[model samples]
Target: MQSLSYVFPVLIMLAIGGYYVWMMQKRGQAIQNIGPAMHAFFARTGFRYDHMPPEPIEAHVHLAMQEANNWAPGNRETRYVRMYQGLPINHRQAYLYDDAGMSMSCNWSAPLPGPPRIPFHVADRSLASLGKAMREAFSNTTRCWSAKHPHAVQTGIPQIDGRFLVFGRDPNAVRWLFQQNPQLVGALLQCVEVDLWVDDRDAVFADPMQKNMNAAMGGMTGQMALGFDVAKRMELSIPVHDRMSDLLLMSVRAACQ
Candidate 1:
C-alpha cells in the first residue's frame, strides 16, 4: 500500500506536467500562425502594423491602458496605426492582471482635432454578465467611466437601445450624434461585440474579448476539475482587424462631422 501511494503521486505529477507542456505548445503554434496573417491583413488595409511606439500619442496610449484596467506597464502593444479622414487611429492590445486572472484586450483610439467634448461611453448589453464579472474581479476604477458620469442616452431605435448601454454628460449631443450618423450606428451593430468611449480628446473603441474570456475561463475550470491549477490568463484566439477598423473609421468620421 505504501509503494502504491508513492507511485500514484508520481503519476499525477507527470500528468500535470504533461498537460502544461501541451497547452504551451498549442499556444506557441497559434502565435506562429497568427503573426503572418496579421501582417498580411494590415498590409491590405493600408494600416502600418507595429511600426511605432504608442508613447508619442499619450492620450491614445493612456485611454487604451485604462480601458483594459492594466496598471502594469509595457504589455501594451501598438498593433496598427493609420490616418483616416484627417484623424490618426491607433489600435493596441493590452493585458490586465488581477487576483482572479489576466484578461487580454484589443482597443483603438483616435485623437479629436479640437478640445475635449462631453465624454460618453457605450457598452454592448450582451456583455453585461461578463462586464459584471470583470467589475467584481478588478478595481472599482476599472468600472466604466460612464458609471460616474451617470446620464443615460437612448437612441429611438429599439434595436440599438436594446443592445447597448449608452451614457453621456449631454443627452442632446449624444442623441444628435447618433441621429446624424446612421452609418455610425450601423458600424456598431455589425461587429460581434464593441465598446466605445469618447472623452474630450479622443474616441476609443474596444473589442473587450468577452467571448474569449468566457471560453478561457470555462477551459480553466475544466482543468481545475482535473486537478490542475487554473491558468489565470486569456488570449486572443484570432484577430478581428477588419471589423474593428470599420467601426473605428465610422466613429472617427462621425466625431469629425
Candidate 2:
C-alpha cells in the first residue's frame, strides 16, 4: 500500500517481504483475514489480561526463562518473546513473570500510533528467529532449575547479541539503562538483544491449553503448572519501565556500562 513510488525502490524489499508473508501463510495461515486475525489475537490477550476501558491490545510472550535466574538450562536455551510495530512511543510493557522463583510471563501493550507500519521483511524474519529461540528454550526445559517453577516467561531479553533479542518499550531508555550500569556485563555477554515490538497475545492465552496438554500428554500435572498473568492475578502491577529494570537489571546494568 506504500505509494507506487515505493514500487521500484522497495521492490527487492517487497519481494523478500512477500516471500516472508508467503512462508507465514504457509506455516500458520490465519483462518481469517489479516485485520480480524491480528485484532483477534491481541484483543484476546487484552481481554484476558484486563477487561478494562479502551480494550488493551495485549501481546503475550514467553521469554522462555528468567534472564536474572541465570536461565541456566543446557548449553543453549531457546525462547520466543515478541515482535510488534505501529505502537505509540509511550506504549507500556508489563511482564507476566512474578517476583517469585517460579516461571513468569511477559505482557506488553503497543498499539501502533496510526497503523501497522512494520515491514514484513524485518518483523517477519525477526519473528521467525525469535520463535526458533523460544522453542529451543522450551524444548530444553529439563536443563534449567527455573523450569521447575509453575510459570513461563514472556518478557524482554534486552541483549544486543546476534542470538537473543528483546525489544525495550523505549529502546532509547533501555539503551541508556545499559550505559548507566556495568555490572550487567555478564548478562549482556549472554546476548540480551532488544528488538521492535510485535503482538503475541495468544502466547499468554494459550497457557491453560499448554498446561492441559502437558498434563494429558506428558503426565506432568502432579508437578507445578503454568499460568497466565491475569489482571486478577496482579496483586502488584507497576509502570512497565520499572518492571523492566527489575527483570533486566543485570543486563541493563551492562548496557549502561
Candidate 3:
C-alpha cells in the first residue's frame, strides 16, 4: 500500500510534467502561426515589417525602457513602420523581463521634430488589482522615503487624475500639457490597458502583460489560463491596425502640442 501511494504520486507528477510540455509546444506553434498573418497584414497596409528592428530603432527602444529599473528588453519579434501625419511611427512587440517573469509588451513609438525634452510616464491606474495596488503603494512609499522618485503629476480633471498615475521631471509642464490639450486627455482615456511615455527623442505607448491570478493558478485551471493567455497575446500582437494608428497619431499630436 505504501508502494502504491508512492507510485501514484510519481504518476501524477509525470502526468503534470507531460501536460506542461505539451501546452508549451502548442503555445509555441500558435505563436509561430501568427507571423505569417502579421506579415500579410502589414504588406497589405503598405507598412514595412521586419522580424527584428533596425539598429537605430533598437537603440531608441533600449533607451526608452532603460529608466524603469524593473524591466529589461527581450525578444522583439515584430517590427512595423509607417509614416503618418508627418511623423514616422514604429510599432513592435517588445518582450520585457523582470524578477517575476517575461511579458510581451505591445509598443508604439514616434519621434518628435524638435529637440529632446524632459521625459514623462503615464500608467493606467484602473488596471491594478488589490494586490498590485498594495505592491505599488509600498514601492512608492519606499521610493518617497529614499527621496529618489519623481512626484506624480495631477491634472485636476477627476477622470484623468483618477484613472492615470502620471510622473514627470517637471510637474507644472506635465499639468500644463494636459490642460492645454483636453483632446489628448480624451484620446488617452480611450486607450485601455496601455501605458505611455514621452522621452527625449520619441513618444511611446505600450501595453505590457499584467500578472494575475490566472497566471498563478494550478492544475486544470492553470492549463486553461495559459491557453487564454496565448489567445490574448495573439490578439494584442495584431490589434486593429487602423485604430492603433489613429490613437498613436492623435495622442502624439496632443503630446507635442
Best by TM-score: 1
- Which model, 1 or 3, shows the larger TM-score? 1
Model 1, clash count? 2
Instruction: List the lowest-lDDT window of 10 residues for candidate 2.
Output: 200-209
**What's the lDDT of the predicted structure labeled candidate 1?**
0.61
Q: Write candidate 3's Cα lDDT for 103-190 as tens digits.
A: 5655677877764344567777644446566775876521111111277888777888888888777888778777877766776776
lDDT of 2 by residue, 1-257 (tens): 66887787789898999998886564343222333433443343222222133433423221111232243343332222222221121222222333443343232233222322211100112334546578758875311111111222222333433333333344454444444544443433422222223222111111211222233322454332312222211212222222223323232223222
Q: Which stretches of candidate 2 lie over 4 Å from their true place?
A: 1-106, 116-257
Per-model TM-score on C-alpha atoms: 0.59, 0.21, 0.55
Rate residue 207 of model 3 by lDDT: 50
* Candidate 1 wrongly placed segments (more than 4 Å): 1-3, 20-38, 41-79, 83-87, 96-106, 115-120, 125-144, 147-151, 207-239
Per lDDT, what order, best first? 1, 3, 2
What residue pairs are clashing in model 1?
116-200, 117-200
**RMSD after CA superposition, every candidate:** 8.4, 22.2, 8.7
How far residue 205's Cα lies from its native spot in candidate 1, in Å, is 1.4
Instruction: Give residue 142's lDDT in candidate 3 (0 to 100).
Output: 16
